[model samples]
Target: MDRRLPVSPATPLIDRFGRQITYLRLSVTDRCDLRCVYCMKARPEFLPKADLLTLEELTLVCDAFISRGVTKIRLTGGEPLVRKDVITVIETLGTRIGPAGLDELCLTTNATQLPKYADRIAAAGIRRVNISLDTLEPDVYRRLTRGGDVNVALTGIAAAKRAGLKVKINAVAMAGVNETHLPGLIAWAHGEGHDVSLIEVMPVGEIGADRSAQFLSLENVRAALARQWSLTDLPDNTGGPARYARIAETGGRLGFISPLTGNFCDTCNRVRVTCTGELYTCLGKSGRIDLRQPLREGGRDALDDALDAAMASKPLGHDFDVSPGAAASVDRDMARTGG
Candidate 1:
């Protein structure tokens, strides 16, 4: 005999899909130091402080989500560390949940400022860090980032390592643009004791149309690597939703994120909060629920309602099959959209 009971639409916590919303990607600010060509065309005006979510308001929204089963929180942005008093934000959230209570509290930064803030970050109870480093050559770095200091970024990675934080390097693979140095970057990360994530060039922001020229899938990259090195699945290191494999001769690991050719949406468990407080269920979607208006009007109840709507609207998967021109027309610039 079965003893399971049916759930009602009035269920207080779970969403329509029965997937517990347990992760929140909070974008602290839309401002960034580097204007990476793929991320933005030019420097953008800083969003007015009044328009952005205040610390108190952000905490309230986070609390609402936490109450509904959100256990992991990540701080992101055009570059999260660029915001002032960011440490205060981290500390305030840390007080709500003990170090072990929250399943994970992580962050993603470009790493230009990480070297200086690494210690403060570790002290604030942040455990995981992902630094974006696409190229090893200084000239190539300048070309991609539109004149970013590659040396500074490298130094920041080293500082994070010294601070005892779990660090990962995110390399956005673009063919003819840093593809030749892919192996070298992986080997360097391995030697430095950091995890390397090779991601497919995803067409997500206002520049999605331009992706046709810059975007390259991970399939070609995997084939190239396989020919040069023997890969074996790593033991006991199952990265949720993504595969982690090891190279035979190297003491390093490689990660391939193939969203174009292969999709992992079935296991997707993340929700993004725009800097202006809009909640987006999927990264590829143009629609988002504006929480700012409701939050300013009704407080906690409003936040809960907004979160519920976002979870309910979570799509089954993203459609990159849409023409690049069409994709760009619908979405905001990547920096503004919190990619």
Candidate 2:
């Protein structure tokens, strides 16, 4: 069974709405060192190692997407660095970056294990990394991540900088938790020459907490910051849903990903693949297409067919709601959904 996709290019993955899918967020593992309150439960039931797609299979999938015109691949996970030999995955994908292949290869990590792998990550051709740092207060960080260390994450950020990897901070804005600290966090991140994006809590998985209570709209966040800092809108698109603004005070960029307050579905150009090879066309939707079975059972043709099916079924937008007492729009945790 030859599982490799042909080197020739295929038709671009364009949805019914006419948006070309050029980005893929591939999760290598669902396991993480910290259980962020908004992402997962304190004690999550991780999938068995045998259930995940093998490294070879992952590469095959990447090749398939690249053949179909997906140019940017972002490695994501509960924590991508926690995946064993993840650098190998990065290195494999890095080879695809060129004029005729992928334009960029990057990663999104919680940064707990980054200090150990930053140099290797940079060497593997990852020029930029998006690090998750919700709060700078040690106590608040511990409370949000369920016993995780903030200093460790800080050290990882420093290491990533030392390795010459551009850093971007992703902070999930919570109403009472990190609301007040966000200003200072943004200032500090900007001062350190790192971009920061503030995200509103999405109704993705049930983590035994009231999401409505935790939900802090980016509208409010931006308004609050406007009072303190001069924010001028910027026309920068990072191939994601985030809307960018330049802070006049910090002379830094700030992004806002408001899945609830602002719907970014009309221009969505990406898809997420779980570690188990499940393709999620929309993060706020539960619909999925299984690519692992096709790759294993029918090889390249079957996998390409599955990818086409996924693009066809890609929804116009997600229906994420954080209204009081509303259940999660998607029951899968952000960890399992590729962050």
Candidate 3:
């Protein structure tokens, strides 16, 4: 181990392979209202409350990350709003870290619990909202989610848009599952002034395990859409989160998350901290640096050193491209990992 750290807090913190760590994805809670089959097992159990990082500890960690060049922060959850005093947690973090410190603050939600709290969340300084809508058809939605209410999620999405939040819909494009609804979802969200993204179903964990038949690549879906719509490449950004373009003249835009197709792993700058306080350097790979133990034993400085170590330890890129067999064999559950 080199054990060399970033020399200055002002310099963008570069990892061992020189990847700059700029974004931090924080999972507020592991508890969720719906049991999405992709994210969890049927009737999956929850992480004990005691194991989760308290609001105060989360805030302290965010402060330290921001100081070391983490300019963006996104709060995630098994269902973030389901956490008690959720809005307050948002307010506390937002007030403590603003654009001066943290350039962007956002959240990823399933939208089931969003209708009740969208306005409150927007008012609390959330910059954008990414709602996960796998399918627009109610029957298929229920089938995929196992028991979630489609109407409830739609209502929440409407509330989020009405609240003036930048809204984006995330759909997992699974073959023979929700892929058929892609065109309709694109049309719907475009008409409503929202961006829709089609993500390839990741072969992670136990739910989609051994179910290779369900995987759908971006190329297959793109070829399907290219017949009707002429697509153009939108300008790329440093973060490379969304690869977006307009849908001809319909005023609706589409995005493709081609993680499997092109492997954007080289530029991956994110570090995910699960609700249980484990810091994950890459979403697709495993093994985390434990921050909770350091936080409990040594206060804020220890937390800072942990952040520094994690940023330095991030890999140049994931091994998915070179070792396709290993990518399929990796077995961490997405829900527990806060995907």
Question: Ranking by TM-score, best first?
Answer: 2, 3, 1
Model 3: runs farther than 4 Å from truth? 1-11, 97-99, 236-240, 320-329
RMSD of each: 5.8, 1.5, 4.4
Stretches of candidate 2 above 4 Å error?
Answer: 1-4
Candidate 3 whole-model C-alpha lDDT, 0 to 1 = 0.78
Q: Per-residue lDDT of 1-339 in model 2, one digit per residue for the tens?
A: 124566654789998889999999999999999989999998899999999998888889999998999999999998988878777778888888898789889999988888899999899789999999999999999999999999999999999999999999999999989999999999999999999999999999888889999999899899989999999999998888899999999999999999888988899999999999999999999999999999889877888889889888998998888889999998899999998
Better of 1 and 3 by TM-score: 3
lDDT by residue (1-339, candidate 3, tens digit) is 111222334446678877788888889887888887667778777888988888777776777677678888888888888998767768876774555477778898998877788888888888688899988899999988888889999999999988889888899888888888888888888888988888876665666334456678888998899888888878856254668877885677788887778677777778889888899887767767999988779766677778777876776655543133434434667777776
What lDDT does the true structure give each of the candidates?
0.76, 0.91, 0.78
Residue-level error in angstroms, candidate 1, position 279:
0.1
Query: In every candidate, how many clashes are there?
Result: 0, 0, 0
Candidate 1 has what TM-score? 0.90
Query: What would the TM-scores of all predictions be?
Result: 0.90, 0.98, 0.92
